[model samples]
Target: MKYCAANYQFSFHSVNMRRMNDLRGIDLNLLVVLEALLAERHISRAALRLHLSQPAVSHALGRLRQLLDDPLLVRGQGGLVPSARAHELAGPLAEALAQVRILLGPSGFQPATARRSFRLAMSDYGAMALLPGLLRAVRKIAPGIDLVVSQASREAMTAKVADGEIDLALGVFGQPPEGVHSTELFEETYACMVDAATVRGLGKLDQVAYLARSHVLVATHSERVDAIDAAVAKVGGRRKIACVLPHWSVAPALIAGTNLVLTTARRSLAAFEEDPRFAVFDPPFPLPGFGFSLIWHDRTDADPGHSWLRERVIAVAAGDEPDDAISLRS
Candidate 1:
């Protein structure tokens, strides 16, 4: 069938206007319940998450289904599953709620007395370098705040942040994806870490020795190649990869008695600095390093709680007092 472009555009605009007008009559709180229901995918679980009675959540779900003109969820063999329309609404709903939270302003945040949970997406390197100081500061000041750390690929991090699943992401991102906002936390340099015994026998590592020896590669989420490999290729060299591990925390134990050399961010060395088993050195060939950034969605840019957390993160990363952290709003 043929279609007229102008007629189609007018119909789309009218439908959107009708939806907006319908939205004006619905209790805005239903959106919150819809978000929880979509995420939990079960009425009881959504109620528990929202701290509401099951009946209240069910009622809200009914209202949501009517408003959106879809059975947003239904029983499945595995308890419950979101309908196609529910899946479609999930991302935009989350974004809209985040915007509403931001619009309410920062008056809701009271770190000293607030009990809040923050989910952070970061690599093991970032967690190691930042968490120790962040935890200490949190305990001293915002004792009621809790942190949940998770790992995500660069691709996943952008979506997670935009959808309000991750409150912040910490990592080396050369260019942030659209809709993601970021601030440079610090610049990092690569360093070689080896067992003291191995380094003692080999002395200072040169390009020849570096390429000849077996190495342990630390791989982050969804990253098959790392900076070390790229640097080697740039210098027209290659090394034997003895093992591949996911987290930086395991690198020390893996390198303890082996001849394997590990190359990682210099700041990460602080964790193993005093350990007698490890030695740190500069790579024989110059390796490319990265700048770490604190990433978040623009929706949370003006949120006082998020802003306060960002300040703490910046302070921890920069080794400054929490009081000294700069305000993003300013």
Candidate 2:
């Protein structure tokens, strides 16, 4: 496998050196634009993904074609089709871009001086119980950071997370969508919340006593039959559903003067335990607790700021304490 002539070896080495020099002369940003274009296979979609104008991406493509001396892309049935050279470049280009991203990532996170805002989605109960401690920690350590919390249905929240609309979501995720990643944050057991006045003789609920009274359920939708129903079914009984309410805040007040009983997370009734008007008790039947998890996309997996915040959230959840940000009431 030797070169037949010394002249042929010399020519090969010269061409290879010039090719390496030519690659070094191209802009890094143009490679980024090329990666997106090859991926999306359409000018408009690539532009949207890069947050760049269509004219700018088109112009970049023109430059790429000239530099590579290849057509790069040709129109086809669905969208732009990559040339043979473009196909050859696709795999290597993507891997190179990924390496570049890692090379340029933040060396480390400085929570004390970093200014960032993250959008978090959770339920009303979650906000009351978890936000106080998390807010306290953030204020004491990272005063420049901000958290915007909101509520959405599980389905909608999953979609928002996949699309990068929501930075994180804390909730009971049975099975999260494909594009997002999730990890267990904590677990919570159910408890029955009711007024103390009418429960002297019927304090501890057996199945009969539990089902005898009217119950008000807190759910985003009435069609959701939760664990309570499944447990009740196993016991061969069903509780009377007097009403289905959306928010947990209003359910306790609604049960104050009526026979309505509210079944909810035990931690949610923390402030109401010692109050004269309320009572918290274990469910008459056995019901498994739910695993609350943190949902986020893989795009933020290596971000220094996001990693720091995630650890803080897990710490707060483990050692939850109330802060002045919110107050629980009857």
Candidate 3:
């Protein structure tokens, strides 16, 4: 005869059949009673601890002796003493009970005292737009919490979340992967950045001037087409690509001395607001903005720590306070 256990098929032979049957008939709650009885020794004390009658405790002890095939407790000169097998089971039984208590108890996450480290996967652009505020908020509230950020491609974020490699991911996911939950944080629009000294006669760039100028393509990953390029293509226009780079950080410095224009997310331009060398303007065409979402696996959906982290991320993205206990930095 074949039996299925956790997707595996195995045959039970005569040698182990009784052990499996014993396990099937075992009541897990009896372990709790056994643990209490072993700790208290006396039936009355054990009943008090377990909120049961003395007779109930004695009956449970009788069941325990039959299960173990040994008298767990016996009378001695001073008081009830543990048998050899009971003494052998005490240490491991105590450890297992402690683990079960923790598993059954509340998650017990206190942000003020929690010393947790979380790994996040996001594109460089998303990090640039969100990290400064997120770090500030986290530092003031969860001072003990730590964050590790990684740059993952759009294709890899879903797998990273599902495999427990990344706790959360932030990006413009048009179609999120199956089994992943996402909440839209905000809609992000594009802006054209240029050097004030190098570019002239461009107050608000028209499609004609936008396409005529050389552009620095901020391709953080090796994708062939970006949002701006796709938008321009829809309108039967294309910008001249002078160079392609892997990060948004280098685009400002590269565009400062040259006539190259960089088109990227509007939130990313906040870093260059006070810099006299860079100029920010709206994109020439009416390009559709993309929505940024916080994505996590279903496995973490009900976890208290994971829920707290997601709330913080959403609050920071929405430019609001996390809670009354925590305040955002100016």
Q: Estimate each model's TM-score.
A: 0.78, 0.66, 0.66
Per-residue lDDT tens digits for candidate 3, residues 1-330, read 233562342334543567747766887777778776665567786676566898887888888888888998998775568888987776567446545544664665567776656668888778887888888878887888878787877778776665455669998776776778989999988888888775556544678777888998988677758888889998898888999988877677888787788888888888786677777888888888889888987656666666778888998899986663743221
- Number of residue pairs clashing in candidate 2, backbone atoms closer than 3 angstroms, sequence gap of 3 or more or interchain: 0
Among all candidates shown, the one with the greatest lDDT: 1
lDDT of 3: 0.76
What tens digits encode model 1's per-residue C-alpha lDDT throughout 123-217?
Answer: 88888889889988877778888777878776777677777667799987757777789999998998888888877865457888788889988
User: What do the candidate models score in CA lDDT, each in turn?
Assistant: 0.79, 0.78, 0.76
Query: TM-score ranking from best to worst?
Result: 1, 3, 2
What is candidate 2's lDDT per residue for 165-256, written digit by digit as tens?
56688887768777678988888998997777778766656678788998988887557587888888899988789988788777778888
Candidates, ranked, lDDT? 1, 2, 3
For residue 54, give model 2's deviation from the true position in Å. Answer: 25
Better of 1 and 2 by lDDT: 1
Alpha-carbon deviation at 70 in model 2, angstroms: 29
Which is better, 1 or 3, measured by lDDT?
1
